[model samples]
Target: MDTKSLLIDTATTLFQQKGYKSVGLTEILKACNVTKGALYHHFPNGKEELLITCLHGLNEVITTDIKAIFSRHLSTKDAILSMIDKLILNFEKNDTIIGYTFSSIVSEMATMSEPVRIACSALYENIQNLYHEKLLTEGYSNESASAIALLLTASIEGAIMLCITQNSATPLKTIATLLPSILEVNK
Candidate 1:
């Protein structure tokens, strides 16, 4: 890839593996094999700016994936069930769920930077909005769709964390098995 994209990808991977606080520009530059001057040329505002860019790119990619999943199925339940299955298969194969990396950022740096904080919050809302719209199309009440959207987002995030911590997809698998009842109209 190009230098700018290379820098961002390396920094993002380091941030995911280490954390924003633990990583420095020097480390990122070293990881990318780029110099400090080269980084500043692209990211004049430095590390926070780079991270904010990373977050924005992640938001677009992840929301697009979510939107695609929501659109690929006729029912909200089917879409979400497919998402859960994909989550399990992804974790099993790659040992990493890319979107789940956002949780680590929230835990490590939410209070440290305003722009970055807002970026993360927007990403989460975008995800909820996608689900909310999908559920609304299925004739769910506004309140139910809103609440279920939140539940789905939060539950999947939590399950991914559990999967990562336990080094197994069993938590997400369990969620997949139990999610159908929760998605019922009467629920």
Candidate 2:
């Protein structure tokens, strides 16, 4: 990857491990092996700007992953289970999830920055829509699909936060068990 891409990747990883507020530009610089001048050149507005870009990029990456996973499975339950399984594996490998670290970053910085708040909201909306589309595909009504999508996104994000804080993947595993019931359709 190029300097800008490398910087965003490095910063995203750091922001995932520690929320945006806890990470420093110097650390990002060191991690990416790029100079502050290069970072400023790519993100003239600075760290917040870079973080917003990273957030947007992370959302797109997640949306892509969910879309692919959803397409691979005809059933919503299987798709979501596969997703959770993937999450569990990733969390086991990294101890901190890649794009999944998003919730805490948003919770930490949303009120402090309008751009960050907007980015986080957009990310949530996009993920919800992905689930909503899947539910609709599986014969759910629009209202039910919307509600379930909201519930799923909130539950998964909350579980990720708990897993991160508790230093264990039990919360995610527990949530995975509950998803099948949550995803059940009455239609």
Candidate 3:
């Protein structure tokens, strides 16, 4: 890829592997094989700006994937179950070292940088909104859709954390198996 994208990807990977506080611009440049000039040319404000950009990039990727999943599934339960499966597959494919990049950074930077915090918050809301829209398309009322979406988002995040902490995808699998019952509507 290009130098700017390389720097961002390298920085993001490092941040996810390590943390924003622990990663430095020099390390990012070294890992990316770019220079200070190249990094600054793209990220004028340096590491913090790069962090925000990386978070936005992650958000765009995830949001697009979620939207596509919703479109493909049509049914809310199908979409959620598919998402859980995909998440587990992705974690396994990446050896479980990769995860929501923003989550790792946001917890550390939330009190330090408003921009970083806002970016993280906006990403989460976008995810929730995607869930909400998909549930609406599945014919749920607005109130039920909103609540279910929020619960799904929270549960999925928690499941991911459990998968990471436990070093297994069982949590995600369990969630996938149990989630549909939660989404089921009685006639």
Candidate 4:
């Protein structure tokens, strides 16, 4: 891989594991075996720039995957169920239901960093919009659909956190089963 890509990937892994404020530039340099000059040559703003790059990379992964899953013209309920299943599959594959790169960082740094906060917030809004659009297409009123979409997003994030803390997918599974009921779907 190229230097920029290598740096971003290494930084993403480190930040995901250790968080944005906790991880340092020196560690990233050492991990990538690149000198400070080389790092600055690629990212002039140092750690912040790298962190932003990582955030953007993760945002693309999230938005793209979500859009792909949501593009199917299923009913609102079915679309949500499919999205939940996608989350479960992702968590299972990675052996981690928590520690999501962007979510974790947003929670950590949003209070302090304007740029990071804006990026994270925009990402979340985009996802919520996608959900709302799907709901509207399924015949729900706009106001109710947007609210439900936001609730589902918040619930899924909370569920992921709970599952990670307990080191089990039971909570996630429970949420998946309960989601349809909460959404007032007969299925």
**Every candidate's lDDT:** 0.85, 0.89, 0.84, 0.79
Number of clashing pairs per prediction, in order: 0, 0, 0, 0
User: Which runs in model 1 stand beyond 4 Å of their true positions?
Assistant: 185-187
lDDT per residue (tens digit) for residues 19-119 in model 4? 88888889999999999998999999888888888888877877777777777737666776787776677678876743353667878989988988888
Please list the residue runs of candidate 2 whose C-alpha ends up more than 4 Å from where it truly belongs after superposition: none
lDDT of model 4 at position 58: 77
Error of 2 at 134 (Å): 0.6
Q: Please, what are the lDDT tens digits per residue for candidate 1 over residues 29-75? A: 88889999999999999999999988888888888888898888999
lDDT of 2: 0.89
Q: Could you tell me which 10 consecutive residues in candidate 1 have the lowest summed lDDT?
A: 178-187
Query: Better model by TM-score, 2 or 3?
Result: 2
Q: Arrange candidates by lDDT, highest first: which order?
A: 2, 1, 3, 4
TM-score of 3: 0.93
| Each model's Cα RMSD | 1.5, 1.1, 1.7, 2.4
Q: Which stretches of candidate 3 lie over 4 Å from their true place?
A: 97-99
Model 4 TM-score relative to the real fold: 0.88
Q: List the residue pairs that clash in candidate 1.
A: none
Pairwise lDDT winner, candidates 2 and 4: 2
On TM-score, the candidate that comes out on top is 2
Q: How does each model score on TM-score? A: 0.93, 0.96, 0.93, 0.88
